[model samples]
Target: MVEITNMCRTTGCAIGDIKLYCAGFTSANLINPLIFRHLPTPNHDYCIVNNGNPLSAGAVLSFHYDNTFMYRDFSVSTVTCIS
Candidate 1:
C-alpha cells in the first residue's frame, strides 16, 4: 500500500490520482477520474484491492479525482479536468 500527496499545478492538476500495479508484472492498471463540482467536500471515498499480487518497487500508477463540492448551476457532481 502507498500514499501520495502533492500541490495543485496549472499545467497538470491532479487533486486525487490513483494507480495500481502488480508485483513481478509488466502491465499496470490505471484509474483516472473526472473531477466534478458540487459533489461533496471530503465526500468521496475510494478503495482499491489487489487480488493478483502486491505492488513492488519501480511500479508506475496514476489516477485523478474531483475535490470540489459545489456548483452554481447544478446540485450534482461535475468533472473539472480529465487526463
Candidate 2:
C-alpha cells in the first residue's frame, strides 16, 4: 500500500508518471522489475497494490518518479520483521 501526500498547499502535483519496483531476497542484488506503472491519483491519493505477490523478509520495494518543473522527488522505506 502506498499513500502519497502532496505537500504543495497551493498547487497539486501529478503522480501519474510514477513507477513501482520490487525484488525479493534472491534477486536483491539485481534491479527489480516494474511491478506497477502509472498510479491513479485524485490529488493526495492512497493507493493499494493488490496484484503483486506478498512481500517476504529481505524483499526490497522502491518507486521512481520524474521531477520536472516545480516537482520534487520523495522516497521512503519501512521494514518490519516478525519472529
Candidate 3:
C-alpha cells in the first residue's frame, strides 16, 4: 500500500484550468489500479487523477489545459508505501 499527496500551482492561468500528469511504480513492479486520494488546497480547484481509470506501473500520465502558454509546478508533499 502507498499513499501520495500531490501539491501543485499554476501560473498564467487559473488553477482550475491547469492539468497535471503523473507516473507510479514500485521497484520493478508496476502498480495497476493506482489508488490515491486528492487533498484540498486553498483557492485551488484543480484535481489530479489517473485518467479516471486505474494506473499501471511505469505508465506515463499526461495533463493539458486550454491555454498551452500556462506553466504549472507540481510536488509530492507526502509519499508512503511499503518498500
lDDT (Cα atoms) of all candidates against the true structure: 0.28, 0.32, 0.32
Better candidate number, 1 or 2, judged by TM-score? 2
Question: For model 2, how does the per-residue alpha-carbon lDDT over 1-83 read when each residue is reduced to its tens digit?
Answer: 22434233332332222323222112213322444332345432222232233343333445443323322232322222222
Q: Which digits, one per residue and each the tens of the lDDT, describe model 1 over residues 4-45?
A: 332334434432323222222111333332311111225322
Give the poorly placed runs of model 1, Cα more than 4 Å off.
Answer: 1-46, 49-52, 69-83
Candidate 3: segments with Cα more than 4 A from true spot: 1-40, 51-54, 79-83
Q: Estimate each model's TM-score.
A: 0.22, 0.28, 0.32
Per candidate, the number of residue pairs that clash is: 7, 0, 1
Please state every model's RMSD to the true fold in angstroms: 15.8, 14.6, 15.2
Q: Which is the leading candidate under TM-score? A: 3
**True-vs-predicted CA distance for residue 1, candidate 1, Å:** 17
- Candidate order by TM-score, highest to lowest? 3, 2, 1
